[model samples]
Target: MVGGVKEEYQAAQELLTCMGANVVYCGPVGSGQAAKICNNMLLAIGMIGTAETMNLGLRLGLDPKLLAQILNMSSGRCWSSEVYNPVPGVMEGVPSANNYQGGFGTTLMAKDLGLAQSTATDTKTPVPLGALAHQIYRVMCARGYANKDFSSVFQFLREEEGQ
Candidate 1:
């Protein structure tokens, strides 16, 4: 995403497009950052929701793969469920399948959520879910998951089950 004076953005748009980048002029300065913060907040919330749902489904004897498929085909479908499912063995070539390594780290997610929290507070927006997601990521970072993929929230929830 690009954010700046409209003319500047328009000037760079063609070059960005030529580089095979999907560029969008969000608006004036700082708008791109705002958009990114909002997007990441939603992404974090979605991942956590997917993790919780997968865990509950497993506890209820539903197959992870089947549950994911059902969710994908239903109104529950989301990027988290369809593209970056948090359940191991539910999808291949994702951080979950590879043991939650080499993807977006929990620490990074926590930082982004922190920014989201600050932004929400500044804008006086009530982001209860985003705040909760921020807290969850903060706890994950403190529980030795700082280096793990954000999707490892599934593992975190599973471990919590025994505690």
Candidate 2:
């Protein structure tokens, strides 16, 4: 009765949970979704902050490549700076080099952040970073790069700075 196929989504989710299948990678309202939502929020915020930091570097006359190199070697570096530097010509491994191709799509990121924000609102949890991440993602979609890698947020920053 509880595992009816009509709404098999939640029913299967519960059955798996009861069976100790905590490491699931898909389906609705599972741990995977939770992890995805949380990490996307973190990733989005990281991209935003990385963009701001890179903006500062450009303003200071530092070559993005040089700044990226140092950031990769230092505590200031993160996944965005080291593995996914958004500035073209700064990093070789990121999708940004090929016009921001590959990596997580921005539309999915925005959706994840929006989901997290809604969950936070329902739970009365304050997630300012998540909210800001959601808004920035909206801008990315508005700018027509929502299909690019989430790291494409750097492009948004560069545009905002009048460069």
Candidate 3:
């Protein structure tokens, strides 16, 4: 949670915890937002990378399930590649397997990426991949995938390739 004074921060955290939120006490008023921005930035990049990898694998005639398994077992493994594989049929019970519903929306991802870009600019930090990811999500939003789960990036990329 964001801060007011120490007591306020602790009180808010306690309240959030009582509400079943896994409240992490970020230092200052903006630090919680900063932390969330960073997290979503990384998540956007990972989701995009996972989609690209899966698309490439499919184009090369690799089985989607096998490719996802290989990626999960190899150095390429990440949450996106393993727990939330973007390719349909690669994993069940995730957004992709269910038509990209009921997960983090692309519009929200874009908004978070925009926040990351703004924060990076404010800090004079270089975030090349993060910037690219922001643009990707922005485009996805413009293309009408705003409300879809972010993992629908796989479908977006596939449609772009005329698959």
- Per-residue alpha-carbon lDDT of candidate 3 for residues 1-163, written as tens digits (9 for 90 to 100): 4544667877667667886667777786778788888888999999999999999999999999999889889999999998988888888899988889989999999998998999899999999999999998999999999999999999999999999
TM-score against truth, every candidate: 0.95, 0.79, 0.92
- lDDT digits (tens) for residues 17-135 of candidate 1: 98666788899999988888899999999999999999999999999999999999999999999999999898999999999998999999999999999988988999999999999
Error of 3 at 46 (Å): 0.5
- Whole-model lDDT values for every prediction: 0.93, 0.81, 0.90
Residues 76-124, candidate 2: write the lDDT tens digits: 8788887788898887767888888898899988899989998888889
Clashes of each: 0, 0, 0
Q: Give the candidates in order of lDDT, highest first.
A: 1, 3, 2
**Model 2 local distance difference test score:** 0.81
Q: Write out the backbone clash pairs for model 1.
A: none
Global lDDT of model 1: 0.93
Better of 1 and 3 by TM-score: 1
Determine which window of 10 residues in candidate 1 has minimal summed lDDT.
16-25
Off by over 4 Å in 2: 1-29
36 Cα displacement, candidate 3 (Å): 0.3
Please list all clashing residue pairs in model 2, or write none if there are none: none
